[model samples]
Target: MMFKDWLKNKTTQLFFVLWLHISLLNLFFVNKRGIVFLWQNNSELNTLLTHFVTALTATLFYIAIIKIRLRLAEKKLTLGNNVFVFGSAVMLALIGFFLF
Candidate 1:
Protein backbone atom coordinates (compact mmCIF):
# COMPACT_ATOMS: atom_id res chain seq x y z
CA MET A 1 0.00 0.00 0.00
CA MET A 2 1.07 3.56 -0.63
CA PHE A 3 2.38 5.46 2.37
CA LYS A 4 -0.23 8.20 2.48
CA ASP A 5 -3.03 5.79 1.74
CA TRP A 6 -1.83 3.47 4.52
CA LEU A 7 -1.79 6.30 6.99
CA LYS A 8 -5.42 6.97 6.23
CA ASN A 9 -6.43 3.70 7.82
CA LYS A 10 -7.35 3.91 11.48
CA THR A 11 -5.69 0.61 12.30
CA THR A 12 -2.47 1.76 10.76
CA GLN A 13 -2.72 4.98 12.74
CA LEU A 14 -3.17 2.99 15.91
CA PHE A 15 -0.15 0.93 15.03
CA PHE A 16 1.90 4.05 14.81
CA VAL A 17 0.86 5.08 18.29
CA LEU A 18 1.58 1.62 19.60
CA TRP A 19 4.99 1.58 18.01
CA LEU A 20 5.77 5.00 19.41
CA HIS A 21 4.65 4.11 22.91
CA ILE A 22 6.49 0.82 23.00
CA SER A 23 9.63 2.44 21.67
CA LEU A 24 9.46 5.15 24.31
CA LEU A 25 8.99 2.72 27.16
CA ASN A 26 11.77 0.53 25.89
CA LEU A 27 13.98 3.53 25.43
CA PHE A 28 13.32 4.75 28.96
CA PHE A 29 14.46 1.49 30.51
CA VAL A 30 17.11 0.51 28.00
CA ASN A 31 18.69 3.93 27.92
CA LYS A 32 18.70 4.09 31.70
CA ARG A 33 20.80 0.94 31.89
CA GLY A 34 22.88 1.72 28.82
CA ILE A 35 23.74 5.19 29.99
CA VAL A 36 24.72 3.99 33.42
CA PHE A 37 26.82 1.20 32.04
CA LEU A 38 28.54 3.48 29.56
CA TRP A 39 29.41 5.95 32.30
CA GLN A 40 30.72 3.33 34.68
CA ASN A 41 32.80 1.48 32.13
CA ASN A 42 35.43 2.75 29.77
CA SER A 43 33.91 4.14 26.62
CA GLU A 44 34.51 2.06 23.48
CA LEU A 45 33.55 2.35 19.84
CA ASN A 46 31.42 -0.77 20.00
CA THR A 47 29.53 0.50 23.00
CA LEU A 48 28.94 3.85 21.36
CA LEU A 49 27.76 2.08 18.23
CA THR A 50 25.06 0.30 20.20
CA HIS A 51 23.76 3.57 21.56
CA PHE A 52 23.74 5.08 18.09
CA VAL A 53 21.68 2.18 16.83
CA THR A 54 19.21 2.64 19.66
CA ALA A 55 19.02 6.37 19.09
CA LEU A 56 18.37 5.75 15.44
CA THR A 57 15.54 3.38 16.23
CA ALA A 58 13.95 5.71 18.73
CA THR A 59 14.22 8.61 16.29
CA LEU A 60 12.62 6.62 13.50
CA PHE A 61 9.81 5.56 15.79
CA TYR A 62 9.21 9.15 16.80
CA ILE A 63 9.17 10.32 13.21
CA ALA A 64 6.66 7.65 12.28
CA ILE A 65 4.48 8.70 15.16
CA ILE A 66 4.53 12.31 14.05
CA LYS A 67 3.94 11.54 10.40
CA ILE A 68 1.04 9.20 11.09
CA ARG A 69 -0.63 11.60 13.45
CA LEU A 70 -0.42 14.49 11.08
CA ARG A 71 -1.33 12.58 7.97
CA LEU A 72 -4.24 10.78 9.56
CA ALA A 73 -5.75 14.07 10.55
CA GLU A 74 -4.78 15.72 7.26
CA LYS A 75 -3.47 18.72 9.14
CA LYS A 76 -0.18 20.55 9.61
CA LEU A 77 -0.03 20.85 13.38
CA THR A 78 -1.86 19.31 16.28
CA LEU A 79 -2.01 19.86 19.98
CA GLY A 80 0.68 18.23 22.15
CA ASN A 81 2.93 17.38 19.21
CA ASN A 82 5.67 19.52 20.62
CA VAL A 83 5.32 17.92 24.01
CA PHE A 84 5.75 14.44 22.65
CA VAL A 85 8.64 15.42 20.42
CA PHE A 86 10.44 17.44 23.06
CA GLY A 87 10.03 14.91 25.83
CA SER A 88 11.27 12.03 23.73
CA ALA A 89 14.14 14.05 22.32
CA VAL A 90 15.26 15.15 25.78
CA MET A 91 15.33 11.60 27.05
CA LEU A 92 17.27 10.51 24.00
CA ALA A 93 19.66 13.40 24.36
CA LEU A 94 20.46 12.36 27.91
CA ILE A 95 21.24 8.88 26.68
CA GLY A 96 23.25 10.32 23.77
CA PHE A 97 25.61 12.36 25.91
CA PHE A 98 26.64 9.31 27.87
CA LEU A 99 27.08 7.36 24.67
CA PHE A 100 29.85 9.63 23.42
Candidate 2:
Protein backbone atom coordinates (compact mmCIF):
# COMPACT_ATOMS: atom_id res chain seq x y z
CA MET A 1 0.00 0.00 0.00
CA MET A 2 1.01 3.61 -0.53
CA PHE A 3 2.70 5.18 2.51
CA LYS A 4 0.06 7.85 2.95
CA ASP A 5 -2.77 5.41 2.46
CA TRP A 6 -1.14 3.04 4.96
CA LEU A 7 -0.85 5.75 7.54
CA LYS A 8 -4.54 6.56 7.24
CA ASN A 9 -5.53 3.11 8.35
CA LYS A 10 -6.30 2.68 12.07
CA THR A 11 -4.69 -0.75 12.25
CA THR A 12 -1.56 0.56 10.65
CA GLN A 13 -1.41 3.46 13.08
CA LEU A 14 -1.75 1.20 16.09
CA PHE A 15 0.76 -1.25 14.75
CA PHE A 16 3.30 1.45 14.01
CA VAL A 17 2.99 2.88 17.49
CA LEU A 18 3.31 -0.52 19.13
CA TRP A 19 6.26 -1.50 17.01
CA LEU A 20 8.05 1.77 17.56
CA HIS A 21 7.57 1.50 21.30
CA ILE A 22 9.03 -1.98 21.46
CA SER A 23 11.92 -1.19 19.15
CA LEU A 24 12.86 1.93 21.06
CA LEU A 25 12.75 0.10 24.35
CA ASN A 26 14.92 -2.68 23.02
CA LEU A 27 17.40 -0.24 21.49
CA PHE A 28 17.76 1.69 24.72
CA PHE A 29 18.49 -1.28 26.97
CA VAL A 30 20.74 -3.13 24.54
CA ASN A 31 22.68 -0.03 23.57
CA LYS A 32 23.13 0.99 27.16
CA ARG A 33 24.85 -2.26 28.06
CA GLY A 34 26.92 -2.36 24.89
CA ILE A 35 28.08 1.22 25.29
CA VAL A 36 29.02 0.74 28.89
CA PHE A 37 30.95 -2.38 28.08
CA LEU A 38 32.79 -0.64 25.29
CA TRP A 39 33.58 2.32 27.46
CA GLN A 40 35.07 0.20 30.20
CA ASN A 41 37.14 -1.80 27.74
CA ASN A 42 38.54 1.48 26.33
CA SER A 43 38.18 0.59 22.69
CA GLU A 44 38.11 4.00 21.02
CA LEU A 45 37.13 2.87 17.54
CA ASN A 46 34.46 0.50 18.70
CA THR A 47 33.05 3.07 21.10
CA LEU A 48 32.86 5.71 18.42
CA LEU A 49 31.25 3.34 15.98
CA THR A 50 28.72 2.29 18.59
CA HIS A 51 27.81 5.86 19.36
CA PHE A 52 27.49 6.73 15.69
CA VAL A 53 25.28 3.78 14.95
CA THR A 54 23.10 4.45 17.97
CA ALA A 55 22.69 8.11 17.06
CA LEU A 56 21.93 7.32 13.45
CA THR A 57 19.28 4.76 14.30
CA ALA A 58 17.72 7.04 16.89
CA THR A 59 17.57 9.91 14.43
CA LEU A 60 15.80 7.77 11.85
CA PHE A 61 13.32 6.58 14.44
CA TYR A 62 12.74 10.16 15.51
CA ILE A 63 11.91 11.20 11.97
CA ALA A 64 9.50 8.33 11.49
CA ILE A 65 7.74 9.19 14.76
CA ILE A 66 7.36 12.79 13.62
CA LYS A 67 5.83 11.71 10.36
CA ILE A 68 3.34 9.55 12.23
CA ARG A 69 2.40 12.41 14.50
CA LEU A 70 1.91 14.81 11.61
CA ARG A 71 -0.29 12.41 9.69
CA LEU A 72 -2.37 11.70 12.78
CA ALA A 73 -2.76 15.41 13.42
CA GLU A 74 -4.57 15.84 10.12
CA LYS A 75 -7.51 13.92 11.50
CA LYS A 76 -9.68 14.73 14.49
CA LEU A 77 -7.73 13.92 17.61
CA THR A 78 -9.21 10.99 19.44
CA LEU A 79 -8.07 9.45 22.72
CA GLY A 80 -6.30 6.69 20.88
CA ASN A 81 -4.42 9.12 18.68
CA ASN A 82 -3.50 11.32 21.60
CA VAL A 83 -2.16 8.40 23.58
CA PHE A 84 -0.13 7.03 20.72
CA VAL A 85 1.34 10.36 19.64
CA PHE A 86 2.09 11.69 23.08
CA GLY A 87 3.42 8.38 24.33
CA SER A 88 5.79 8.11 21.44
CA ALA A 89 6.87 11.73 21.83
CA VAL A 90 7.65 11.20 25.49
CA MET A 91 9.55 8.00 24.82
CA LEU A 92 11.56 9.64 22.04
CA ALA A 93 12.35 12.60 24.26
CA LEU A 94 13.52 10.29 27.04
CA ILE A 95 15.70 8.38 24.62
CA GLY A 96 17.18 11.63 23.32
CA PHE A 97 18.05 12.65 26.84
CA PHE A 98 19.60 9.27 27.53
CA LEU A 99 21.74 9.46 24.42
CA PHE A 100 23.14 12.95 25.05
Candidate 3:
Protein backbone atom coordinates (compact mmCIF):
# COMPACT_ATOMS: atom_id res chain seq x y z
CA MET A 1 0.00 0.00 0.00
CA MET A 2 1.04 3.63 -0.33
CA PHE A 3 2.71 5.47 2.50
CA LYS A 4 -0.24 7.78 3.03
CA ASP A 5 -2.67 4.90 3.11
CA TRP A 6 -0.53 2.97 5.56
CA LEU A 7 -0.22 5.96 7.85
CA LYS A 8 -3.95 6.58 7.76
CA ASN A 9 -4.72 3.00 8.66
CA LYS A 10 -2.23 2.99 11.50
CA THR A 11 -3.60 6.24 12.91
CA THR A 12 -7.18 5.02 12.77
CA GLN A 13 -6.27 1.79 14.49
CA LEU A 14 -4.34 3.60 17.16
CA PHE A 15 -7.23 5.94 17.83
CA PHE A 16 -9.67 3.05 18.13
CA VAL A 17 -7.44 1.27 20.61
CA LEU A 18 -6.95 4.45 22.58
CA TRP A 19 -10.70 5.00 22.76
CA LEU A 20 -11.24 1.49 24.02
CA HIS A 21 -8.63 1.92 26.69
CA ILE A 22 -10.09 5.20 27.87
CA SER A 23 -13.60 3.77 27.96
CA LEU A 24 -12.56 0.79 30.03
CA LEU A 25 -10.58 3.00 32.35
CA ASN A 26 -13.53 5.26 33.01
CA LEU A 27 -15.91 2.39 33.51
CA PHE A 28 -13.71 0.47 35.93
CA PHE A 29 -11.60 3.04 37.68
CA VAL A 30 -13.17 6.46 37.59
CA ASN A 31 -16.12 5.65 39.81
CA LYS A 32 -13.96 3.78 42.27
CA ARG A 33 -11.84 6.88 42.57
CA GLY A 34 -14.88 9.09 43.09
CA ILE A 35 -14.25 11.13 39.99
CA VAL A 36 -17.87 11.55 39.02
CA PHE A 37 -18.88 15.03 38.01
CA LEU A 38 -21.68 16.05 40.31
CA TRP A 39 -22.81 19.17 42.03
CA GLN A 40 -20.70 19.04 45.11
CA ASN A 41 -18.07 20.94 46.99
CA ASN A 42 -15.10 22.61 45.42
CA SER A 43 -12.89 19.69 46.37
CA GLU A 44 -15.00 17.22 44.44
CA LEU A 45 -15.03 19.43 41.37
CA ASN A 46 -11.29 19.82 41.59
CA THR A 47 -10.77 16.09 41.84
CA LEU A 48 -13.01 15.38 38.89
CA LEU A 49 -11.34 18.02 36.79
CA THR A 50 -7.91 16.72 37.73
CA HIS A 51 -8.77 13.18 36.69
CA PHE A 52 -10.30 14.39 33.44
CA VAL A 53 -7.23 16.46 32.64
CA THR A 54 -4.87 13.62 33.39
CA ALA A 55 -6.74 11.24 31.11
CA LEU A 56 -6.83 13.83 28.35
CA THR A 57 -3.14 14.58 28.70
CA ALA A 58 -2.17 10.94 28.69
CA THR A 59 -4.28 10.24 25.59
CA LEU A 60 -2.67 13.21 23.79
CA PHE A 61 0.79 12.03 24.77
CA TYR A 62 0.07 8.56 23.45
CA ILE A 63 -1.17 9.98 20.16
CA ALA A 64 1.95 12.12 19.80
CA ILE A 65 4.22 9.13 20.32
CA ILE A 66 2.23 7.09 17.85
CA LYS A 67 2.50 9.86 15.26
CA ILE A 68 6.23 10.04 15.79
CA ARG A 69 6.56 6.30 15.42
CA LEU A 70 4.53 6.35 12.24
CA ARG A 71 6.61 9.12 10.73
CA LEU A 72 9.88 7.46 11.69
CA ALA A 73 8.78 4.12 10.34
CA GLU A 74 7.75 5.78 7.08
CA LYS A 75 11.24 7.23 6.86
CA LYS A 76 12.74 3.76 7.42
CA LEU A 77 14.11 4.63 10.84
CA THR A 78 15.01 1.74 13.13
CA LEU A 79 12.32 2.15 15.78
CA GLY A 80 9.66 -0.24 16.97
CA ASN A 81 6.13 1.06 17.33
CA ASN A 82 5.21 -1.71 19.74
CA VAL A 83 8.02 -0.72 22.04
CA PHE A 84 6.86 2.87 22.18
CA VAL A 85 3.24 1.83 22.72
CA PHE A 86 4.07 -0.51 25.55
CA GLY A 87 6.41 1.98 27.19
CA SER A 88 3.85 4.73 26.98
CA ALA A 89 1.17 2.46 28.47
CA VAL A 90 3.37 1.47 31.38
CA MET A 91 4.28 5.07 32.09
CA LEU A 92 0.64 6.11 31.96
CA ALA A 93 -0.38 3.33 34.28
CA LEU A 94 2.26 4.31 36.78
CA ILE A 95 1.18 7.92 36.64
CA GLY A 96 -2.46 6.97 37.18
CA PHE A 97 -1.62 4.75 40.10
CA PHE A 98 0.36 7.51 41.75
CA LEU A 99 -2.28 10.11 41.13
CA PHE A 100 -5.07 8.00 42.58
Top candidate (TM-score): 3
Q: Which model is ahead, 2 or 3, in terms of lDDT?
A: 3
Q: What is the lDDT of residue 62 in candidate 3?
A: 67
TM-score of each: 0.35, 0.37, 0.42
CA RMSD of each candidate after superposition: 12.3, 12.1, 7.2
| Models sorted by TM-score, best on top | 3, 2, 1
lDDT of each: 0.60, 0.60, 0.66
Clashes of each: 0, 0, 0
Error of 1 at 38 (Å): 5.9
Model 3 ranges off by over 4 Å:
1-43, 80-100
Q: Residues 26-93, candidate 3, lDDT per residue (tens digit)?
A: 44324566766433442365655655565667567767877887898899988578986998899899
29-59: candidate 1 lDDT, tens digit per residue: 3554464222433245565455556555666
In candidate 2, which residue pairs get closer than 3 Å at backbone N, Cα or C atoms, i.e. clash? none
Tell me the spans in candidate 2 whose CA falls farther than 4 Å from its real position: 1-43, 77-100
